[model samples]
Target: MAAKLVTRCSLLMQVLVFFLAVVPDAFALPLNRLKSLTVIEEVNRRGPYLGLITVIESEENAFFATGAFKPHKTHPFVDLSGRRFRVGKIHGEKVIYVRCGVGMVNAAAATQQILDLFDIKGIIHFGIAGNANDSLSIGDVIIPKQFAHTGIWDWVNLYSTTNLSDVVHLDIASYNVPKGEGTNLLGHIGHRNEEFYSELGKPNTAQPLFWAETSKHWLHLAANLENLNSTMNLSDVVHLDIASYNVPKGEGTNLLGHIGHRNAEFYSELGKPNTAQPLFWAETSKHWLHLAANLETSLSNGFPVIVFRGLSDLAGGQSGENAISKFGPLAALNTAKAVVQFIKTLQ
Candidate 1:
């Protein structure tokens, strides 16, 4: 009996040592421990943030809040899981800022992380976005009232026997399938899961909600900013049109001086007197762009979210390469300015 007891005690001690070595600190901590072994502890130290600001790219952050508004000099960033959350004051409002990285997935993850870790009232996502609208200029700021996740979908398998007639489907096979020896997809099917909320009691099953609407109160506040004060002049607009149309170098003449003095020598060499003017550019109310990019990661987060996306590139809708490389910084800066002004309006 004494020998068996000693063996059991030795085994128990070894097991306890192994368990201690294997278990993480988070799980090993006592129930009474107040300090957390997670991002919550790291964030709570300098948090109770008024709002959370999210950006997409490094350049966007550089021009947006990093250069203009500026993060706090002392412990500016809270590095958590490879993401640097910039803790700062924008217009005297305590805010936590972070670059959401690029794409909808990155945006969703970062937004969720901020919401989970920090004590923020709302989310304000701003970044340079691809534009397809002709009326909106490169540096224009667009505060979309509604945002949608159009990228989420199911690529229907051609071989599958699933009948999806009731569902919204796009038949890609109808558009001539490539004759090459690769597998071809027949169509794309969309999903519309009911947004069930325990607090709301019943999910709104009226219609499939594709668009996630932004905060109306935030939109109302943003509308009061200065209007039609775009820094881009007629000259800049005209030059962009020239690039978009890809007019032959010698064929086009800047007769109206929209793009500096007309090349008199070139016109003389071509033996054509440039008399006619091209109406390539027009002005619209610069308060806000009517359209925005399709990225809506934060809009569906169930929190009060507002987005201010600066028109960066034309999304290859233009003739040549994308214009983001040339004007992205400017666009980001413009949107940042709008966001700063908007934050000032908040109480």
Candidate 2:
């Protein structure tokens, strides 16, 4: 009986030893007494490092896709319209590319989503805008020196009535769709008529009569720019002259009649012509205004954002049939290229 009891005790000791041997080191060892604790702590306390730059496009195909970055994930694309998100690499630089869709609301939403989901250092909005100013041609690129939310007060009450006393000096000018006028061309000036006419090979006649009228239109545009500068506190508003009003050659007379006489003064006097309404359709600026507002908010939050637009149509009702068909897409491509170039500069 004594020998059996001793054997049992020996087996019990062996079982305990086996169990301890098989246990994980983490559980067996006291975590508080680990020698590598300091190393792990150091790794955990690392500071903010440079992250990948993100480029977002309103259209998927609008993206140039030549950069050094590759799409980080493929499982679920980031999109509002189920449009697949694509990522590519350019020179070891990471670019997360996604189509945010068209218009201001989509652009703003996309910007927010990208900011929330990724570590984006800067944002570049690359798209096409109808050139409200006539001097702009089909493929000219415009880097907004300043953004104006035109006619802000006309529709919404952004600033409170109580704070009306605290006038936030707006640097940009606003346009009010003049009252009772369906398409009164008042308040509107043809700043780029001479440039447009010049491009059309119909430079204003050198005759004194033409020069005086042309001079008036030039002064009018100059005055408008000056007023804009004063209000926006910007020294210079940079605009590119692309996109023209090209009526079919045979149909020129009819279109010209609709646009009124060829004189620059006549065009300038016809403020906000219904014909030009499509290009300046308050909807366009509304789209841009949302973007500008979001950008302003982001900037306030200490993020850097820039907007780049290519002029695709003359804001005035001056687009020729061919201009509508060809220049629009071409202008968009040029804008995309410019965006690509601009991104490279950021790196």
RMSD of each: 10.8, 19.0
Q: Tens digits of per-residue lDDT for model 2 on 233-268?
A: 111112322222343323434322122121111011
- Find the 10 residues in a row with the least total lDDT in model 1: 263-272
How far residue 195's Cα lies from its native spot in candidate 2, in Å, is 38
lDDT of each: 0.53, 0.40
Task: Tell me the lDDT of candidate 1.
Answer: 0.53
Q: Which candidate leads in lDDT?
A: 1
TM-score of 2: 0.45
Off by over 4 Å in 1: 1-48, 64-75, 157-167, 177-208, 226-238, 242-301
